[model samples]
Target: MTTARGDSPADETGGLTRVLVADDQALVRAGFVALLDAQDDIEVVGEADNGEEAVRLTRQLIPDVVLMDIRMPILDGLGATRTIAGEPGLAGVRVVILTTFELDEYVFEALRSGATGFLVKHTEPADLLRAIRVVAAGDALLSPGVTRRLVAQFASHAKQPASGADLAELTDRERDVMTLVAEGLTNAEIAGRLYLSPATARTHVSRILLKLGARDRTQLVVIAYESGLVRPGWQ
Candidate 1:
């Protein structure tokens, strides 16, 4: 469902964003590869046709980002993401789930399983590129509206029970930042809303992540909801 558009010269390896794409459909995979390969800052390092192979290639390639489809043979994207996230050596690698629909049922589970975020298969080429760049730069792809809906819909059924003990670990300021983060505010936006400098806001987020032992901001969002620190339909 990816749309290929304009071409650009390749970037040198020194600063290139290495990526691996895993999808069952050949055409879809090809489209993603073509579009990414044309970007000056990105490079497609490997391709996998199944979840098992996706895990293998991801370990071998050590890609900065993995674009993984939710369904595949031998395993699923959620399983592979869990495997990758649990690996100590691959901690820096970010996984972005690819779904056929924006609100795919497994999207919330995928985020819980350690995905940085997700994108619909039909996402625009430029947006997809920006998502890759964002994830590669250590930011999650969560949009407030979609993420709130998707997580709220499925988080009530989450395997992990609600635990306010997690919230007890944060300072009041960190808690405020976490709430805004669950609302899908970026560091800059959070800074604006809280009347703090962007750097200070980022520090608060970092401290929250450390205190909660969250993998990243995406996981923090999950914690915020499932722990009842933030509730559904609350502005």
Candidate 2:
């Protein structure tokens, strides 16, 4: 993807989050660039018209976060996300998918492909900005309520049964943390429920991720469901 200059002034010196917007629609890209550029802590660094370009610009410009639209001309957002997430050099970069349908099938695939989270196109600007910041700060953006419904809707259709052996490496406390994580509890919520310090809860979550070889909280949720660590419609 070729880099297009943004309307806002550059603020790389201010420790701002650099962002790249990728969408097939010019209007959508322009609107996102304008909204994100207005923020004090965010700078719209570049824009791309397709997934292939998005991937190229990601490697070239190395922006902190990518606002990626799922459908595009050449390559799709899922393909681009896979490329970005698979590269060790681009590990610092994150992707938040843009989709029109809230429960689009591609959304699940996007998450599996390494996208941190997704937002429907009609999402409030404030929420959109928040999602960008959340992903950029190294956190996944799946809300608990939405995650539960999504997972419940899809989990039963999974071809493989949940596996107990996959979680053999985790200690009992780490398993508890993983269950809460799969339930979409933030570290603070997990800390409160388990009577642990937030820092301790965070550490537990980190250890769980490391042990499971998961990329982020979303993957942890997937594991919780797929490994039968947590199930739908059961307390």
Candidate 3:
């Protein structure tokens, strides 16, 4: 069931970021809602006890971000993510996986399933706030070294790279930017390393995402490894 967070979906017309929290644990969900609701720039519009309701509320509320639990009844997080991703109407909605286990195998799958970020339940409140903003602003929450390690670990076992997953579609500079992205470097860091302007680096990333038909930077990282554009521990 979906619980309206007191604020109707229409209340999100302001600049405040609308967020939906989905978790099976009542206390945890309340904690997240309380923390997020306290933020001036954020608003918790709805809450769900499972992934199915999460997707339902997502479609109904059209929130900017969804904090989804990986383990849920009816539909798991990954399944929910895939469904949301498959819907063209939900393109603006970014799902961030919330897990107690940082390296859960499904975390990588969640990314491939169209989740743009992953966060452990123990993440600091400040970091959690930053993550929602970042993901909402069109960047992925894959900056954590654990994210890189997790992607690399599963990429090794990933089935043969998808057909046409090669980097031939990318220009030389785009390839460089993709490598830095796979290394967990942000736009600023990539610009610093590549000696390009931050805006230019961001442009390159956007182009990469478009040309490769990737959902976001997280998929670009997965492609870099799975397509052999980058290898594990190659730095």
Please write out the lDDT profile of model 3 over residues 31-81, one tens digit for every residue: 999999999999888999988999888888889999999999989988999
lDDT of 1 by residue, 1-235 (tens): 2221212213346788988899989999999999999998888888888888888877777888999999988888989998998898888999999998877768888888788888999998988998899989997445657877888888878887522336777889999999999998999999999999999999999999888877888888888888888888887
lDDT of 2 at 235: 50
Residue 116's lDDT within candidate 3 is 87
Candidate 1 overall Cα lDDT vs. reference? 0.84
RMSD of each: 4.7, 3.3, 2.0
Question: TM-score for every candidate vs. truth?
Answer: 0.91, 0.89, 0.92
Give the higher-lDDT candidate: 2 or 3: 3
Model 1 backbone overlap count: 0
- Spell out the clash pairs found in candidate 2: 1-53
lDDT, model 3: 0.86
